[model samples]
Target: MSTEAVTVPPVRTPTSRGSDFAELSRRIKAAGLLERQPRYYLLRATALGGVTAATVAAFVMLGNSWWQLVVAVVLAALSGQLALIAHDLAHRQIFRTRRPSQACGLVVGNLLLGMSYGWWMDKHTRHHANPNHEELDPDVAPDIIVWSQRQARSSRGIARRLAPLQGYLFLPLLTFEGLNLHASAVRAVARPGLKQRRIEAVLLVGHAAVYISALLLVLSPAKALAFAVVHKALWGGYLGAIFAPNHKGMPTLTGNDRPDFLRRQVLTSRNVTGGRVVDVALGGLNHQIEHHLFPSMATPALRQARPIVKDYCREVGVDYAEASLVSSYAQALRHLHHVGAPLRDAA
Candidate 1:
């Protein structure tokens, strides 16, 4: 954990940003934490896959009983776990080569989680390249909800009415996020433009066919529908809850604001403080600042790199935001509520 003293960069000034990036990168690289451990990755993938399979089996065993609700909860939890694995595979975090990673992503994402790997990679890459950017970051793009004053002001009709209450609605809306992701992926793969669209579309179809068939085989149609809704909604909300705190409350870059790479990432990403269970559940996204700094870094390594990165930023007078999970969500909600005030004014 020893390192040379690094020079501090001035806040909001980009002149010395290159030095900051170089210094931080140097420290992180020096630790040799960047090296991939195949065993770790394989172990995680195997365990999560087992959980997914076991949960699916349990659901089938439950049949049309009142106890299927318990199986649905377990399935939802496993779905979230698989989604995290899919995200890691998407980032090429586990496998050194692209092919294996892509294969794994297809198995976990498209087949198990019912998400399109190609579609997610496209959107996720843009998000990583320009996180929290008002225009470029797909994560923050104006839609049914608004995250900033400009977006709130431009709202119309139903969106306009909902804009003011968006903070309150955020968690509730996440219940539909799983369905939205499925629909969006379907549309993206249907379009002629994406790479390997046909393959991804087939995988998605396979997911739907297998999933629906399994549920309907044992349960009545109405019960199956209920189980599906619960599983998907809970999965979506779990994903959203983990990801939202990473950047929702952070300073967002607009067209005019162009900070250098290190500064922009550090300023925009927030970390959460917790132990291994939280790390596993969040897919090591609890170390979001470190992950954003080094997108390809393995999740296990992110925790080791955290103190080094945090110390460097502290020495350089850069802000490194980290809070408890509860605190971080509250901050995000507060930011959303504050941003929505403009919508109220517009009304």
Candidate 2:
């Protein structure tokens, strides 16, 4: 089959037009998949804290040695992990109440990662409400990269020029995603409407102050710069890789093309198939369909929920897209290339 044909998975139209989502929700609730996993989260948070402390200790002990670059890599990975935890916190996966979830989200996102929790929460909430939507989903909105042909056709200047090769450029561009995220957070807080803007700004400033100070204090200026570059680049790439596969290659819904809830989530999202290590690395995000369906489901329970979701999707005749880690990226890239075809021909 042609790569274009394989880019999007075949979605079976629902055989019965019954209340599919309600039935699936009933099954999932009966399975107790929506229950909070406080104990699991407690253990996860404690472990992450201990590792982060050890990484910091290693950085301090390593002193002015160039070997601290290794520490930078570790720190970058830890930052990604922290961001994943913040994602869960934003979804209220670990906490039952908004107050506790927001509190933890601020600490993990703004205070540690220099990202605005409020900004991310608002954006992610919209994404869950309408995944892969050409107009409504902020994720697919025309940005540095265009996801739809309509956006591609309207692109100007650098974005227009880059559209044709965007498939290949996507991963490379993510190297700067960390910096972009920090910049976005600052811009978000600067705006008037974001909730707790002042608090977010303060915490973001604190993160920057402490992060840069520690780097300069521990290493020479040149080494510190290199360390920062490597750390941020890898952190962005890691986080981007985790999220890119979820919906990029899937069918995008345009105006008035809305599917029912179950079909919408299952058909648009792609699941990554892997073992325990991938689960930990991606922080249960590999089960993208399950995660979207049950946003507040705990990380540990996502794996268990996956089969149930897949089975139900099959019974309802909706496609449940699944791919290996590598293939998922390929599928996404193909879609990018396909979307940019018009731009390429015009060039």
Candidate 3:
């Protein structure tokens, strides 16, 4: 799933930074990069809906055949795309107001994808506020896998045993991410304090009921189970790969290490270098530096904002990190392996 929100702090920068971000912001505003692209989102959503319908038709047509596995892969890709749309919705990139954004997000995330918009919004807000901060960013929090040497040292039980091999196992571990996201949504809705808990709960339950029922009705029990596993696994892997390059190997922040707005985002975020195909696959997340700097900017506009941000960063002497898709993954894996080095030494 995509990580995004518009809850970043106000434009506070250090004096040495010299209103650098303000200048960049002015250029972006003059360029009209912040405006919403209603037509783009409309056509995109329409195309996604049509593809989903066709996939469902194919599922019925194929009917209990082992070839349904192919259909399962298509559904996984579609789910990833739907999640990306929901990500834009959460950021108000499609709709400016909270009501419209939340309405669309719930329909796409909870109803269609069986993921929780409310839960994801909360987690993503903190992440945008602090992209790679060890303590603040939930995306980097130490859990099943650790992101830092300190975390690797503190890891216990399964996490400890897994830490040393985590770099090698990262992709394999991501196969379960789809299940983790669904389970997290369920737990979030079940607990107290989440906004619109009842509505989210109802939508989530409805999605699960319809999804499971459709699978069972269309195929045999064995085939249904296999289809579900493949769909979830591939969906998780696809989404995880999309997000991995954004900040995994980038420098992380910690206690009291606050940089200016531009430096904070530009320093910690890495941009993936690719053409239109990569942009489509990653949902414009390849330009993560731009996305983090302007959380509410529409996905399509990120490409336009990139050069402006990059040039301003150079003038201000902030490092702008960019890498090819393969190189980015390699850098992230290397960082993971390096972090686990202490654990290996201790062993």
Q: Best-fitting candidate, measured by lDDT?
A: 3
lDDT of 2 by residue, 53-171 (tens): 99999999999998988998999999999999999999988888999899989999999999999999999999999888878899988888988777899988888888999999999
Q: Candidate 2: where is the Cα deviation over 4 Å?
A: 1-18
- lDDT for position 93 in model 1: 86
User: After superposing candidate 3, which stretches have Cα over 4 Å from the reference?
Assistant: 1-18
For model 1, how does the per-residue alpha-carbon lDDT over 1-347 read when each residue is reduced to its tens digit? 00111122445443454567887898898899788878888798788768767876787777797688778888878888788888888888888899999988887788877888888998999999988888889998878877777777776777678888988999999888899889988998889998878888889999999989988888898888888888888988998988998998787777756677887788888999999988988989999999999998998999999999999888877889899999999988887887789767766
lDDT tens digits by residue: candidate 3, 59-144: 99999888999999999999999999989988999998999999989999999989999999999999999888889999989899
Supply every candidate's count of residue pairs whose N, Cα or C atoms clash at under 3 angstroms: 0, 0, 0
Instruction: List pairs with backbone clashes in candidate 2.
Output: none
Which scores higher on lDDT, 1 or 2?
2
RMSD per candidate (Å) reads 4.7, 2.8, 4.2
lDDT of each: 0.84, 0.88, 0.89
Instruction: Give the clash count for model 2.
Output: 0
lDDT of 1 at 247: 90
Clashing pairs in 3: none
Candidate 3, overall lDDT?
0.89
lDDT of 3 at 276: 98
The reply for model 1, stretches above 4 Å from the true place, is 1-18
C-alpha lDDT of residue 257 in model 3: 66
